[model samples]
Target: MNLAKNRNEIDPKFKWDIEKIYADTETWNKEFQEIKTLAPKLKEYEGKLNNAETLYEFLQLEEKVSRKLYLLLIYAFLKSDEDTTQNQYQALKSKIQAFAAEFGSYVSFMNPELLSLPEGTMEKFLEEKEELKLYKFMIEDLLRNKPHVLSQKEEALLASAEDIFGAPQNIYNIFSNADLKFPQITNEEGEKVDFTESSYFKYIISKNRDVRKEAFEALFGTYESFKNTIATSLTASTKKFAFMAKTKKFNSSIEYALSPLNIPVSVYDNLIETINNNLNLLHRYVDVKKKLLGVDELHMYDLYVPVIDVPDMHIEFQEGVDMVKEGIKPLGEEYLNIFQEGIDNRWIDVYENKGKRNGAYSWGSYDTMPYVLLNYNFKYNDVSTLAHEMGHSLHSYYSRKEQPFVYSNYTLFCAEVASTVNECLLINDRISKETDKKKKLYYINEQLEQIRGTVFRQTMFAEFERETHKLIDAGTPLTSEELNDIYYNLNKKYYGDKMVIDDLIKVEWARIPHFYRDFYVYQYSTGYSAAMSFTSAILRDGEEAVERYKGFLKSGGSDYSINILKKAGVDMTTTKPVQDTMDRFKELLDMLEAEL
Candidate 1:
């Protein structure tokens, strides 16, 4: 049961060797010092935007320095997240953040000055610096801020003050990751199960009603103790956002937040409208789940129970890789080949271990390959997670290959699409291919959970964020009780009478860190639905869908998030993608009922 001590070692087969990025910590430190010294050289270009060649060299130097800085910063953060309590690791991580704040301050004027360049300065800069070729989109990204980039002094003021503004997220992170502890719950064997945030999901989703209830209650009840602190942190986070919006001259915080993605508020509105229309289908699926579980009462805890209690459905690590490859082959050979490189080249760190980062994400820098971190427990869920993370990695890989470093960073909107596309494809493919009925049911439930968590539940969070922000905007203070009421009510709307709506679920919003990002959670809803629509198109239309989806991946930030989605075939501005996703959920629920 003690994975950290017993099965703690990450299998060489699953571990990625980051040594290739820097070789060793000593080497990294040496490089870090070198990078620190390189900062002052950037000051050489402080006021040098009069000509194309000067701007070009300055931009190239800046980009090169930034690439090195990014690699260094990520390595430190990744290493620290793997174990935050380590003093040395914390020091390294803190140094990186502090350095980054300074680095950002140093380069803050690059944008304001670049925009200040004579009318044709941009065209000439691009023509002059052949090396700036990679940075065309990068420069244009700055140009996009032409409407917003304040003067050099104002921009520097904002940049230097970033650390001061990050107090909310920093406090939340410190409290959640380090300060809080959950009550121990006795397992079926009558042994006390010591719960960590890493293992909270396992307990709260246990098949035993008592385990789920106790875990859910104890975990959240612990959060209740710190609700005041959390609320204060949230207020700071909100005010930080509001201050930035005011300073940027945007009419509202939402507009300022979304302007970078080039997406209009209508897209966000369209998603909520679409989800609102289709929520009945989601409720219907919840109804089916309730009946299938045959529980007299369906609580929030019941939602995560194993629809099938069978545990051996856990596949081996190698088999999980095979499953992901097979699941994604629908995208074509070249696509699969690139993914295989990720698999073989240790682009992934699979399996849970002592001090490993909890959960999973796809991470890497534009200068490096996209790497995935997984705490795999071999459940069918892990298999799906593997596919999901690879989706992000390959998306990064492809965009890096197709676009320059400047255009390399894809918008969060597209980022989720790549991941969800693989997730949906894997779930659908696994369900379609399986012959064992109980296992088939497990497979089906797994897919349903995807919709439940991603498409439906996230929209619920999106709604929560919308209203919560409005609460702030309207000059109404959101106490824990008020926040909970809004969130709990949304849960009721989405799940209806089918599930036991618990009081504890109201505090869920406080626990979710994504709320700090402001208007970001809606992307999960939009992304899931968009993935479903695009996946359906690819499954039915084959080559055309694949090409469009691939083109969408390579688009990076070249287009608005909504426009990229629309061009890729799922028009988020319309309700069709949302409706299509809901219809698919209904079909799956109908099939699961027939099979059961």
Candidate 2:
């Protein structure tokens, strides 16, 4: 697959119309300056938050400025992601970062001040001003953290330290995506290809064992060369989280991270425990792979390659769009119209370019169309990715339309549920309609892999994160050697004795960018489980389930994540969701084994 070396060479229709965010750079600059000017004015309302009218006024002004600031910031961030090397957009993005820190510092007093108000003042304010009802949840959520709220000066210091706190992640992004280079490897066709971050997935899943093995070795080998550097980078990030947690008086970094979402550490522990108890199922799946691949032993590189040889299912971009449209018909015509409009308009950046960001994501502000970025390779998984990201976009669209701006942005805990549910709908629809035995088998295999990747694999990642943070909290230094050993042992525990755990796979943790975000990967597991619950409901109850699912999307941050999911019929606070997900995986594995 040859990639375009220049962005201009790609068709305009294939690229996202990010220009629609602003008419031009001048217009963006105009708004940028306006935000800078408007931000500091919030200081005038600093001490006056004690008064009902002044508090209402300050909240209104804060929302207005925040909406505009996000629009400008999202545009610059997406533009910079398109080509990280572009100095112009890079500078634009840096300017927004600095402005954001300054703005955050200026507004930092609001929460602490609001928390300091007389015990019943906020409730009285809410009663006196009907207009303030729009912000009732926002105010209450802030006050709920009264114990964690620092003094105004301390809050300002933490706000000002935002950029300094995020330096490690910034550095990792630069080194991983911009500076690092992979060695050239020979492909199946005997052509030498430069292994890049975007190309890593393509090579790793190759049908040819030699090609993928070489690619895997070359990629992790490059990471191994910088093992110490990457280890130190990750350590700094972990320490940053620990420092913040201690300063905020939380019991643990993981606790601090999940508190905002109102999730308990037990939920995290439940996932790890469930996955540990079910390792034998994963081992069984691996054993199936070893037997089907007819290998004496299964290595890490061989796990991704398909066991059943079905004809290649190459889907073009428009075909993928059409297929996705049909797959989601269960969501009703109104939902279909929104999906079609996003695809018809330039809501998605469809194809990869020279320096565009790798991977796919859906992002936007409350005031704008939800935008999706894709490095589309026209494969079956690309279509699945389209379905997944469109789930996120549609969730944003509904939330923005139904809820106030303050509650429009849902937490990551619920965000993944929306996306994974889409993937479930797509996969189930495809499997039901596929007539050819081989293709049906292929779809079954895909479902199996989905459970493996999203459920089992992510749980492994979540456990790694939990253990590493605990180790750091316990005063163990995370040097390269120690990190590698801990990771290798985790691999052994997860994989059991079913497969050969290669030394190269031990360094895999060095390449994961998600680790920097701290306790984030677990959401993928929980979301997938919740999605399975939704899929079962839709299948069982028909339109009733559809309405309930849509209600969950529109609920947004209007309530807590678990409550939102409960309304959708899944209670995540217990061990039931994880068990249900494991049961679903077992059912799928049974079908695949019977077919084999």
lDDT of 2 by residue, 267-295 (tens): 99988998899988999989988998899
Candidate 1 clashing pairs? 298-500
Best by lDDT: 2
Give the backbone clash total of model 1.
1
Model 2 C-alpha lDDT versus the unseen true structure? 0.88
- Give candidate 2's root-mean-square deviation (CA, Å): 3.7
TM-scores for all predictions: 0.87, 0.87
